[model samples]
Target: MHLSEQEPSSWPQWLSVYHKRALLGGGLLLATALLWPTPQLTTGQRIALPLDLSSTSTHFSVPDTLEALADKPAFSTTITTGDTLSKLFERAGVDQQTMYKVLEADLNILALDTLQPGNEISFYLDENHQLMRLEIDFSLARQVVFTQVDGSYDVEEIQKKGQWQPKAVSGDIYGSFYTSASKAGLTAGQIQRIETILKEKINFARDLQAGASFSVALSEQYIEGVASGDSQLLAIHINNRGKQIDAYQFSDGQYYDANGESLVRAFLRTPLAKTYRLTSNYNGKRRHPVTGRIAPHNGTDFSTPIGTQVIAPGDGVVTLVTDHRYAGKYIVIDHGNQYVTRYLHLSKTMVRKGQRVTRGQPIALTGNTGRTTGPHLHYEFHINGRPVNAMTAKIPMASRLNKAELKRFKSMVSQRNIQMGV
Candidate 1:
């Protein structure tokens, strides 16, 4: 969506665009003046050279805006470890107001927030030192550019269906699955994802014996021969003794076995292993006791001790870990596939932002940190960006693919199997 900036505030942004081009348009006058091949004259000197517009062999052309931009001081920065948007903008000499403006413009998109340590961002400023354009390169395959339009910013999201280069890594279990996978050129994150996906099928520590082998068929995205950040597992084959196990990732972002059965990895129904008393249920129609308003209870309240352990219900990336005035210390986790989980009124957080967590992993301790009557854990589950009842709502669970999808999956598997030399 394109937002219009207030007419009054639009001057600074469009100044860089219209004014610069206007200055270039003035270059025609200079070009016309250069037609006189006589000796160089000062400002007071007037050379009466008869210029015929009909047959002047010299061509007059205005300079491009890029040529004008060459004279402006350029701003660029690469996101690094421990770098925040504010910190990077500060380093680039941008004020807080401008940063907020950029963020406000990107409220509906997933650009600014998804930037990692390796991503790149640059700012283009006008003569008044105002941000005219901002470009964020997530990878070689994707980019987001914000241009100053009128008074607001225009957002452009660029995505490329990059070429997927299949890679097969096979090796015998050495010391551990992690070590062997690392030796076979798989990243730690990749190995962890595979373990999480096949967790229900095999216990890497206990199931594998001597002479066990593992084969991973994955694909890495690349654009113009440059690798992008889209490595994903496609199919895996593990042979332990006489038992053979295999799983394939279908197009629906779920894994299944050779028989089209789901390698189902569902979130734990509850974050706590040991059940505590349920103090409150998800009541969307409940009224606030103090505020005397129809403030719906969107989360589940579990009455627990101050130091009760809280575990992650699903595999996800920690998106937020902080304190709130009314909610206390809370942690928000983003599980992919439009699933998210939130834990509020926490005493301690075990994971930080950007950290990957698996199902049943300890993530925090329950406590009353916010506006609460007592110590308890408030949990919320979200699907498609809205809070739902954690106690009843269906979490991410894929049982099996449909007939048409299964046919497509078979074709994908056949192609991948040949690629991996299975």
Candidate 2:
């Protein structure tokens, strides 16, 4: 019977095709069998099924060999600002599955919502398609791991203690601090930190001369032969115009000037000449106006009308300048040694990087840009990479003047106080 003779649903599609072809061959086969005489020895001839043979069953029983797995490279990338957890994983060459596993493994320790810039994620895979390790370089200070166990991962944190090797170098400010420091084999981070340490007492960023001399004794950190981070300022000295200021990082983690005075003795000077209207006070932390997020506000804010000139609190080199959303326009000055000063929320920058500026010199024009509600100058003073409240900073009384200069300043103070009827 032909398959088409039956209903459409009678048999499967594949089976219907086979059955139709079989029927077509059956008529020819019947004719051949009748035309050709029934072959003799038919009793001895018998159809044999492949499975019916014992050897066939044994031969098919052998399984095919498996292929060896390939090895993968361990890779990681540091996170930058405006990065999300998903983006971080992609840069590290990980898929969504791995990212999900990593998030689940250390939900508390590695919160996706709290991830910061400069963090690194490292991936580890085995030949068996298993996630052997999911590591994170948190703050470049430690490595956190998530190890697989029976298909599930367990979190384990490992602190990496970096190695520090003391190095000493000297260079003159031929053109700029960065160029001069780089020529001496110093990284950008190191150069920036040095500017921050000495920003308060000296103003190299804005006042650096072409022939300024600087000497630094610092600890260079190494993680497998790569410079990682710095700890303390072992020693630093900067000489300009016959004035030499030195700072030493003591064993107790305090930075002292060569005169044994604290490098952090005073607050960052307000760059604006007139403190007309105080816009923002020195707070431990403040919210970024543009980002609308809580961040440490390292400086004080002075408000004034637009076009008001801004001054340099200390001598330093202009390191960075940009028109940021919140800061509007900002300038960074690096003081010789490790002191750095930052002036933000400006309408214009009067001075550029590598330009020498003196204390009270015009560096910028006041206005609102970054994280501001009005026009003001945001001033910051950093020492060893940490922001200090500029308002409460107590400047060490300008060194006791020599007898003659002391008498002169005393008379001046007395005369001024009398003139004001104090």
Candidate 3:
């Protein structure tokens, strides 16, 4: 008998064998897929899962490590023209005590008080919803952070000297300097600063004439190809009736002419008429007389009788006149060009906030108001918010540059002039 005739009944058994092998292979594949472990997501990695909108129970969840950050409380706001630090803190739900602590930390740096329009500030809260960190972005290149350390806050500033792109604008004095400068793309603030810099030499309201030419040299700061809106005034020039007045910025941050003569009035080195005995000098590691611990004495102390007149060291606007537990009654004068003077331990403050005082004007009276042993005066000179030894640190008494300094300044001025297209 042939094999084709004999296999007719055995066809079902052969077919069963093929079916069983197919089923076994399918089972192995399904088992392997179901038994495999899912790889975990690394730090900063995220998983995006498609959602079925029609389903009710289906949901997405973040990793456990990221939950804390996602749940943490945070607040941020941009400072406006009338924005204040206290009000901003209140909106962030921070208590006044914490705000005061931040202010106290700002005593040395004074960064918080200098908040300007368009600056951003943020506060981060911990698990307990208490402020843990605060950040202020002053500009694209400047940032300040305050972090809670123990019972106080530690301040750290991150600043970058970004590339500055030079800019120049020139115009004819049509009506007023302010109008002409504004037409030439100078801001109101910039115009005001220029007027202030050249106030001693040229009076824009009185000396500037119509049809006279004026030019400004400024720099627009850039960070990573982004405009920071920070315009630096490099130089200013005005030609009126054939008389030329120039003010060029120098490395010392003061403005001067090509001859290295200061553009502003001189600062009075001794604010008082008569000399007083020096009781304590500025010491970074001085032992505190009250606490008996290592503390930094940021200002010089002079022993004077009560009611001794305290005069302003320079022409400036009084920014603060307030009382403090440790500092007592103090007056802060903000002299133009990054200079500041403080009179502390005063029994009385003669000037009010926002009052402009002359170089020799009375500002306060010395006394033992604070935690001091006797009647004395605590005077401090600050440059860019950091206190220096006024007794030894270089004071700007309308400084006339020396030979070497003048040469360097003239060279710098020439370069700036070319950049300004003058």
Q: Largest TM-score belongs to which candidate?
A: 3
* Candidate 1 lDDT, 23-45, residue by residue in tens: 67796753444342322110000
Candidates in order, TM-scores: namely 0.60, 0.44, 0.72
Clashing residue pairs found in predicted model 1: 5-151, 5-152
TM-score of 3: 0.72
Q: Mind sharing the TM-score for model 1?
A: 0.60
lDDT of 2 by residue, 121-221 (tens): 55544322234565565655555667666555656555456788767777777888889878986777667667766777777667778788777776666
lDDT of each: 0.71, 0.56, 0.72
Which of 1 and 2 is the better model by lDDT?
1
Model 2 segments more than 4 A misplaced = 1-163, 168-217, 224-226, 229-268, 285-296, 394-422
The Cα RMSD of model 1 versus the native structure comes to: 13.6
Which candidate do you rate higher for TM-score, 2 or 3? Answer: 3
lDDT of 3 by residue, 319-388 (tens): 8888765567888887867788888789999989878688889888888886687889988898865689
Candidate with maximal lDDT:
3
